[model samples]
Target: MLTSTKTGTFRFVLVAVLMLLLQACQAGEETTPAGANAGDETSTTASGTQTRSDEGGTDGRGGTLVVAMTAGNVPLPDIVPTEGSEGRRFVTYQLYDGLVRWDLSRDDATSVPRPGLAESWDISEDMMTWTFHLREGVKFHDGTDWNADAAVFGLDRILNQESEWYSASLGGAIATYTKKIDSYEKIDDYTLAIHMKEPYALLHWDLTWVRFASPDAVKTYGNDGYIQHPVGTGPFRFVSMEQGVNMILEPNTEYWGEVPKLDQLILRPMPEASSRLAALQTGEVNWAEVPPPESMEMLRQEGFQVLLNNYPHMWPIILNLQVEPWDNKLVRQAANYAIDRDGMANDLLGGAANPAVQFMYEGHDWYSEDGTTYSYDPEKAKELLAEAGYPDGFETVFVVPSSGSGNMWPLPMIEFLQQNLAEVGIDVEVEVMEWGALIQTYRPGFPPGENVGGVMVSTGSYAPMHAFDRNFASTSVPPAGNNKGLYDNQRVDELLREVQVASEEEFIPLMKELNSIVTDDAPWLFVVHDLNLRVVASNVKGVVMAQNWFIDLDTVWVE
Candidate 1:
């Protein structure tokens, strides 16, 4: 029998309770997919253009919307946020605009690159050089003109270590996106060219995360002070913040694009699901992110909108390849087979997620049909384990975060998987840790604890090329990139190099092939893709809930 040093009975009970509640509440009502017009109606804008309005039937203008985030601590309002992806979702995306941005206006399976600060761009024939045409008449919140010089300054802050304003801390967060660029220069007031070390086809997608900040504000506030008083060219302008409590923003009337409909946007940090649920019930906040799974039906019944949509997110356990048995491919494949993804998705998450067979969702453009399919087959798992010379499966430890952004009910989920893996003879000891501490393990040189086999974390599979490179590239290991697992495959590495220079038509097939190889290798235990759940008051309007981590909030307003 598989034995665990850790007691997970309480977590198992919590999962059981959630499952029972979900079974009782499931009435065949499917989650609203991205792009679906749920409670939306057609309305004409002040400019006489027809547009969709939120359920409240208003012009989506003029109200304060307060949202409770999953972070326990409020993020520093800077170019690189402090609270992992949650910081980017709540703080960075709101306060800054990249040269390129995700097309968050539509509800689609995939969000492509759209113009943000840069109105347009061009690429050289060899694809090694890119020239961006900045939008004229745009000014940062600090009243600094956003010209090519400002863009170069922003790039140097992350890419050039010799620059006085360069930040090693912020640079690490964006290394993957900025690594390929050899250098950048201000060609003119409105144009800049980024010269790559080699041909890179995914520059546009990578640039989406390379957001620019006000150069003048950085100088005045200094490096550390800039985090406190951030200035950017986004639709929302920073107003005030109360440390770990809340941060407030107001719309910029001089915004080049559409101004925010809400007069104010307040973001609060509430890590507990119960706290978020209670806040929603008491009308303390207009929106709550990642509410308790069992409470979704109740929230909907109470006239609140329980929103769920498909996004490029996956909750997986990144195996430590240097660890014993995990170094063996058969043992890794067995663990993948041991997982019961459907039960975890439908039962525990209340259908708020989809089972992940590959890194990408089944219907995604880059998802590979040729990849190995990991079904819930305990017998197959046992057979594979026995073949790998461990008829009686081995014991290992898993480090998991109790809660965080894109991490959906991790305790219950891990407990459920513990039971499934135990049935297949893989005894797992669970080690729970804080989200911030768990995030530290993702960096280079973080030692895996004694007997540690894997770390459970959620990762984004959006930005196809970057995602592949970050997770599977050998060069991406630790200090260099996000390849935390230290997985190395010669064929995979070769394919990655080819894809960087491949033609647009050749890219998809190469990615699909790479996906197949990685799936077969089983470097990580694939679990499920989150449906991006949130609860909003019925009075809240014009929330698009795009199929992305980021959303356009300028269209949102309180009714």
Candidate 2:
């Protein structure tokens, strides 16, 4: 039956009462595949531009946009404590909003930040201190007043190294400007001043991710508080969460902006690739994240919707530079030249992966175009191996995750690289481990001499400071989470620090230098930066997709 609802006002009375009823119902079985008629039959373009019709409707009837995701197994927090699986990001966006959202209007992938909790902000001439004018008449999901103190509490909690939410990446750079935060003083009830130790240009955008929590919710929930009962000044309100099962988010009635049209949002975790796709196909779920290429093609061909957007994330081969065989620069360079990235992008990934020539993607405004790019040459690889004092090639163990094409998982691409390395006399013993175990095994402390050697890791970067400092910094040895391979270089470290403070012109040179050093050192065979395939149902409307992962559900409506 085709039915529609109006946009703007909130729907459903006694929504909280029905939350338990929805939770009680188990996730539906995989949907049966319908024939390919799901695609739009009308293929007319506007002025020669063949664009997908943006008529928001997946099914004729509308309610919630049930999204199937792999993150079901992983217990994600409502507010992001640190760098985590992409699934966790969905919940984070629903609970908290950023200061200035990614401004997608800019060509350079700049964040088009709209006023969230803060109405306006002013930067000092010296660029040391920043004063934020908070928006009055805002309230958390729990009905607590949203004010400057709430922002301070959130920052203080995350910045504190002792707090579990304190990510090492944020701590490294944010800690440096601790002197700037003289105090989180309330100028009035709606204003806060953040004094800085030094000048930080990206402070405004930085506040976008810096979340604030309600004091009441924290005290009530305590240590494990936000998990079940999260409160924030966002478009949606947290209803309930069942461990290892599903999460439910309802539209916040007091939301200051355009209210979400859907009465509720249901996120069901379906880890298996096939099952997730099946759910999307049968209309059991409206959308799914990171569907397999085969599934994506099937769905697209059938008229199902698909969205391909770039992300500031990469999947690279992590080389153990501290180990003996790989420690040789020639072997690293040979391995770099040996692997076939183009084949991986087109074949294994099904044309979704972008070949990563440098550490950062061209999408990132700061990426260096003049950086070195190692081409695929089997003969050159063999020559370099022979020059590195290993004429007969060397044997090593290669580890990868058994799940997820993007992270902790092995594909046909791994098999190809293994074959390519074999041509140079390098024998690879491939080992498949669960994703969590793989992460733990590679993360710094593996006992003194307990070397696991080589593994394929998917490391993501959003900011340059952490990208350079944590991944390639000299002092960033293991256990602290910087050096999984325990690799270190003093010159690279100097350049990283220099780039952090350097102007746009100076930073480009430093970025180029960093790339050249990594290329020469050969610690990793730089692979590809990925583009996330976001599938929104036809009924869902109003979202600005960009390279950065910031999503605004408030603007989304069903009509």
Candidate 3:
């Protein structure tokens, strides 16, 4: 097993031995509206498929699988969503699997189109269209046969305006390359096809996130409610959930693919980093995530196996341009010059993070030029502020997540910024709140000028292009997704739109130009690209760790 340590509060679980069995499984049903459920008699299966006692007992796999995370889980919706908060990743494994599985082994750790519901795919010469071939004999956990109708039904729910799907991070750019989506063809009982308006290189990658769910189960549970009791073709089934407490899942023996060895998975919410580490050491929990430079030494001494890999995640400090002072370009530029990126990377991150110069990482192959890295110059910051009419600087409150490394991890950077800005006479106050509430307060609908000067630091696995535009582009603002700063720039927006649909050559120059603009404007202080610290037990084997870390479940086994 592996182990590591860092400080942050965040919160995932599994259920019965295989005793229950159902002769008559759920059948095809009408599509369920995103979040509507009025005592709907959607569908139900008999509890006679397998004995409950044998369900989560043991699959002959000896050891347990434990994971530690820095973020907490949110409510899971019934509709098959392409994107979600941190909690959605852990919960999705219990209910749905996409048409094509994402391949994390790629150079940029992107989702490569591969067989899931579709066995193979063909592309036209113009690269504007694609035809998919579905596999036969595929069935949902409810015994309903997997067909073209089910695939289209799932897609419809995500794209529907009333569904509130969290797919903007992945699907927001769909308006660009894809001018039209003709239809999802039911070639036969077992085949499916998708026709696009234009060539979208990213669409192939996007399909890896199109997970399928039982339409009947969703109608019964309603949107934002099915997560409590999910039904999918995966190796596990949802049993129960206690809000803010724990979640449980049991193995699905009738799973078409190789069933998981573990009979049960118990996901407990440990909000405090200290408690999470203590749980693993004392056997209260089996696994957890570790932040670098903080918990590295202690976890290593405890004989836990540590895993290191390139994670497609970034940590940036946001400046809300929608508010006063920041709305002024000179004021925003002064804020950028006031911090030391190198110092923050070396001291706070303990060299575990890389100082970012652009929206994308320096390590990516497509990355062209390194943009300007602001040196720690309090004099220059003062000059810029004076030029912007704030000679004595200004005061504002900075909001950060109260629990976990999200808030605590940025203390050093905050301290540096405070000291530098204070030299120019700027006073700043810092406030902390839980991750969930923090997200709600910072979004677009949350009133203008409220909590305008704050930073939200987070790390997760995602393709760089997707991560860059999602965080910086104003068009990505929620309810679309991740545009917390609410920054709007016509030129920057134009560049992002072009890059989204551009080929590799055209994208490189546009990306470089975009990075230069953001650096000059300074609406965001691009912090470090962190390397995730993961620990596994020695008894565990075949652990396939990916940049996202979520794909580890596929290869993990007990020795």
lDDT for position 13 in model 1: 22
- Candidate 2 segments whose C-alpha is farther than 4 A from its true place: 1-62, 72-74, 81-83, 104-115, 123-127, 161-188, 195-199, 362-364, 404-409, 439-448, 475-481, 504-509, 536-544, 557-559
What candidate 3 gets wrong by more than 4 Å, as runs, is: 1-62, 73-84, 105-113, 123-130, 161-187, 193-199, 250-263, 291-293, 404-424, 449-451, 457-461
- C-alpha-based local distance difference test score of model 3: 0.54
lDDT against true structure, model 1 = 0.79
The candidate 2 region of ten consecutive residues with least summed lDDT is 15-24
- Candidate 1 structure quality by residue, lDDT tens digits, 1-559: 2233343311112223234001111122322111122112112111221122245664657888999999878888888887788889888888899887876776643566667788777677777788888889999998889999999999989988999999998898889888889999999899999999987656777888988899999999988999888999999999998878999999988999888899899999888888999999999998999998999889879988877677778999999889899999999999999998999988888888888888777776567887788989899999999999999998888888777777878888888888888889888877777677677655663385655788887888667556788888998887777788799999999998887766545667777788889989999999998888888888888887676788788889887
Candidate 3 lDDT over 87-148, as tens digits, reads 54565655666666544332223222345666666555444555666666777777887777
TM-score of each: 0.90, 0.79, 0.76
Query: CA lDDT of 387 in candidate 1?
Result: 98
Error of 3 at 237 (Å): 2.9
The Cα error of candidate 1 at residue 438, in Å, is: 1.6
Tell me the deviation in Å of residue 233 in model 1: 0.7
Backbone clashes in each candidate structure, one number apiece?
1, 25, 44
